[model samples]
Target chain A: MKLAHIQQILQAEVLTGAGSLDREVGMAFSADLISDILVMCKEHTLLLTGMTHIQIVKTAEICDLAAVVFVRGKRPGPEAIALAAQNDIPLLLSSLTMYESAGLLYCAGLPGISRNPDPCGRAKGERTG
Target chain B: MSEQAKPEQILILEFTLKSLDFMRAGEASSEFKQRLKKLGFKPELVRRAAIAAYEAEMNVIIHARKGVMRFEIAPARLLIVVEDEGPGISDIEQAMQEGFTTASAAIRELGFGAGMGLPNIKRCADAMDIQSIPGQGTRLQIIINNE
Candidate 1:
């Protein structure tokens, strides 16, 4: 999907890099954890998160992410926006919550980046389950 | 190899990773990327160098008390050396496990700590060498081929 398409679909505001809207996105991952993103995100993946930190932008840069969608109406601070702009990373703000935003994107054929199922079936937060 | 034939520009960055400075953690990596870009590295090589350097910088900040990152850039390759004085890993094998992490909740909240730092360094570097003592510190040497 292109950033323009995503902006239209989610009714998002493009905070920066409006010219790069036509960039291709091959996958999507909705998480705030940088490590999980590093491991799971593919090049050109659209990242959905509520966190408004500079690290998110840095993560996108490192992973070569296509765009970042700030779910739950979250707005990044000026410094964060500047960093995103500096990196040519398209930033979007949406009022939709994480689940709804992810669902909408998934329904539109943007699937989550799948990981190998953990044999232990341990959830994200459980320690030693 | 003649010293005169080697690339002339070498950039070195030294910073103190104050414990728990989440906001400033990835700053060095970002700078490293800029340096690589100025050096006119290939896109693929630049990406690998950025990932390895960024991950290593983050590790020093998240896991160690303090550290320094030195970048040696040449026409053929980039050498990155990161040294951190932290509670060294007792079990290197366990630390290498893909999903294992000792990062705290604060660190995880910032989107790191999925235990991929070391793995990322290994993945992005053409060669990686790690030396750590249980109580001393950890030193990581990574080289990314520029050709």
Candidate 2:
């Protein structure tokens, strides 16, 4: 889905990267735990979380995520927004609670990327850098 | 491939840990990951490097008075050296135990005080070595295979 559509559906405020609103997102995940995010998120996925911190932006950068949506009107500090800008990761703030935001995205046909059925399964596509 | 003709390139970054400035903590790791990407490191390796380095960075910020990180890169491996003058860990064994943490409530609220930093480091690095003295300092050497 396009980022602009996501913003409209969730009623989110785009804090940065407004020009990238037409970018497409392939999947979504809702969590504040960095470890789980590291293991589960796919490239270009939308991140929904309640935690507002610089590390969240850093994590998004490392994982190459498309954007972040802050739940429950949580305002990420300036440092977080600055880091997001530097990394070219879009940052959005949503007044909706985490469950409602995630449900909205899910109901809109955005599915979470499931890990391979086998814990040791290898990814079946070209490796990315 | 001509091994003798290729020059080794080393990328180094140094960051100061401001004792209680939680907001600026992950800047170094973010820069480090960017460097790794510019070098064409695989995503899996990049993920491992970022997780290990970020965890170590957080440790220094929450537990140490000051810290420095040095990274060396080659076609075959990535070496990360993290040194800190923080109150050294009293027990490496206990510290390596998953879910063991001395992080404050404030750190926990940031989502990392889960006591999984060291273990996560071990899980990500191909070879890991840590040396610490209770009152002196701590040094960690982590080697990650580029394969």
Candidate 3:
């Protein structure tokens, strides 16, 4: 899905990368934990996170994420916005909850990245029975 | 013509990390990633190396008093060695376990301290080695093959 489409769907404000709205993103991953993103995120996936720190931008850069949408009405400070602009990472802010944002995107034909929660490949609550 | 085989060339990069320096934490690994890209490693290889290196570097920035990250790049592989002066892990085995973290609530607010750093690094690298003294410090080495 194009980022412009995502912005409109969630009613998010583009903090930066206004020029990048036309870029296409195929997958989306929502997480508040940076480590979860680090360990599980696929390259070029769009990131929907509530954390408004600069590390989110750094994680996106390291993982080559498509863009970051801050859910729950979170707003990153100037420094975070500056770094994202410097790194060419688009930052968006939305009033929707993480669940709502993710649901809207999923319903709009954007698929979420899937991963086994455990590295061992066992389902989180699977029973042998 | 020289009969001896040519010695393999290695590129080296060194970086200093300070604890709680959240603003500049990932700069070193970002540079390493860019360098690898400029040298033309495959994107998958570059991403793996960058993720491993960034996690290692963040470990230092999150827990150490100070540390150094050294990168050794060869045609076949990339080796990253991070040495830090901090409260070293008393149990390497436990520290390597996923979801076992010592990070404080403040660190968690920054979206870290999930105890997945070492395990994630291991997942990204082909080989990993760690040595630490409870009070003295810790040293970590990670190698990601170009293949």
What DockQ does each candidate score versus the true complex, computed on alpha carbons? 0.46, 0.41, 0.72
TM-scores, all candidates, are 0.83, 0.83, 0.91
lDDT of 2 by residue, A23-119 (tens): 9998789987775676567778899999997889988886789999999999999988988998899999999999999888766667677732322
TM-score of chain A of each: 0.85, 0.87, 0.87
Off by over 4 Å in 2: A34-42, A113-129, B1-7
Q: Where is model 1 chain A poorest over a 10-residue stretch in terms of lDDT?
A: A115-124
lDDT of 2 by residue, B74-147 (tens): 77888888898978989999999977888888777777677777888898899999999998889998899987
- lDDT score at residue B62, model 2, on the 0-100 scale: 84
Candidates' RMSD to native: 7.6, 7.2, 6.9
Output the lDDT of residue A46, model 2.
94
Compare candidates 2 and 3 on DockQ and give the better one.
Answer: 3
Give the TM-score, chain B only, in order for the candidates.
0.88, 0.90, 0.94
Fnat per candidate: 0.64, 0.51, 0.85
Off by over 4 Å in 1: A22-26, A109-129, B1-14
After best superposition, candidate 2 residue B116: deviation in angstroms? 1.7
For each candidate in the order shown, give its overall lDDT on alpha carbons: 0.81, 0.82, 0.91
Interface Cα RMSD per model, in Å?
1.8, 2.1, 0.5
lDDT of 3 at A70: 97
